[model samples]
Target: MFNDGAFAQITKRDKRDAMLINLVHGEPIRFGVDNERGVAMDSSGRIELVDVVDVGVENLLVHDETADDPSVAFAISRLATAPTMPTPVGVFRAVERTEYAAAVSDQVDAVTASQGAGTLEGLFASRPTWTVS
Candidate 1:
């Protein structure tokens, strides 16, 4: 659980209902909006029907339940910054990191802020990325 209204995940199983999942530490510790069905705007002066919105990997965050020590935090951070990932879409790497240090609430504002634009980009994070390989 991130203070950014982003949910934490130790495994891919935790992302069953996530939307617009952003990379916090990597892909394990995901922070995204909860899934919803509806219409939305496209940032411009246009209305766009939406089902999902994707996020940049710059916010990658890998989850670590036992990250109670400096070594663990370092290790997890290393994983997030790792050069290569065995992804289904082929190899991938976290390009950059988004600095997120703030308070969150029970409302969707935290989740919306995580998307940077407050749009329905969170639902776009719901796409299943990794798989057991």
Candidate 2:
């Protein structure tokens, strides 16, 4: 019930303020907002995170073959997968530019090591706002 022609047309849309994204990371991937799944920028300049979207079929990547080299494969893979999503949805960091989960975990490990006690764990665990929702 989907149109290949219409799907390919996904690339033609505007790409201003495009955020660099990667679920399949090699280099920072440029993703124009096809449509925002849910996250919206608030007046405070803090982006609101609604849900986590992992790197998978459900979080589809929009790419253009004629426009980009690496983009085509990711786009096609997204098209082939079932239950793929449009828009780069999730809590994204402007720095790491990788998948949100990877950025948080990987960067944490890269910065310092986690020891037994009297460590950063206390700082993180003690914070009231740190509890999982």
Candidate 3:
């Protein structure tokens, strides 16, 4: 149950059916004009789809009932950052793998000893010059 002021603030000047529906259902639903643009979350916890034109319909993935603590805020932030559609799942996975590979390469380079200029060129050029001087 939200305060009348809060409810009025959400409903006032917004005649969207989606917003009204969300408000009546007591569930938080987010809307955005486009996927690339900013999203607006209905914090009133009601489902009323009054004006669904400007606000695009997006499915509710997760909800937070106890949002009074810092940890809950962090969890919500993580959820929001997660991929909404599965179309980019493969690309996202590949990017994660590439990032891991780069991190491992950097670590290996840090641990490996630096070779002399001659040895560096030989190693880089894939030429094997085995002479211990």
Error of 3 at 37 (Å): 15
Order by TM-score, highest first: 3, 2, 1
Please count the clashing residue pairs in each candidate, in the order shown.
Answer: 21, 0, 27
For candidate 1, the 10 contiguous residues with the lowest summed lDDT are 82-91
For lDDT, the strongest prediction is 2
lDDT of each: 0.35, 0.39, 0.36
Candidate 1: regions farther than 4 A off: 1-26, 31-55, 69-133
**lDDT (tens digit, per residue) of candidate 3 on 19-93:** 222211223334332222222445664322223345544534233433343443343333323223111010111
TM-scores for all predictions? 0.16, 0.18, 0.20
Residue by residue across 20-115, what tens digits does model 1's lDDT show? 223233243333244332222335523222333443233223333334434434333333232232111212243333345323333447665675
Clashing pairs in 2: none
Q: How many backbone clashes does candidate 3 have?
A: 27
Pick the winner on TM-score between candidates 2 and 3.
Answer: 3
Q: Model 2, 1-133: lDDT tens per residue?
A: 8766544433433432233233233322334354232332335533332322443324333322234344344333343233233334322222324688988988677666654335676887775665477
TM-score of 3: 0.20
Model 3 lDDT-worst window of ten = 86-95
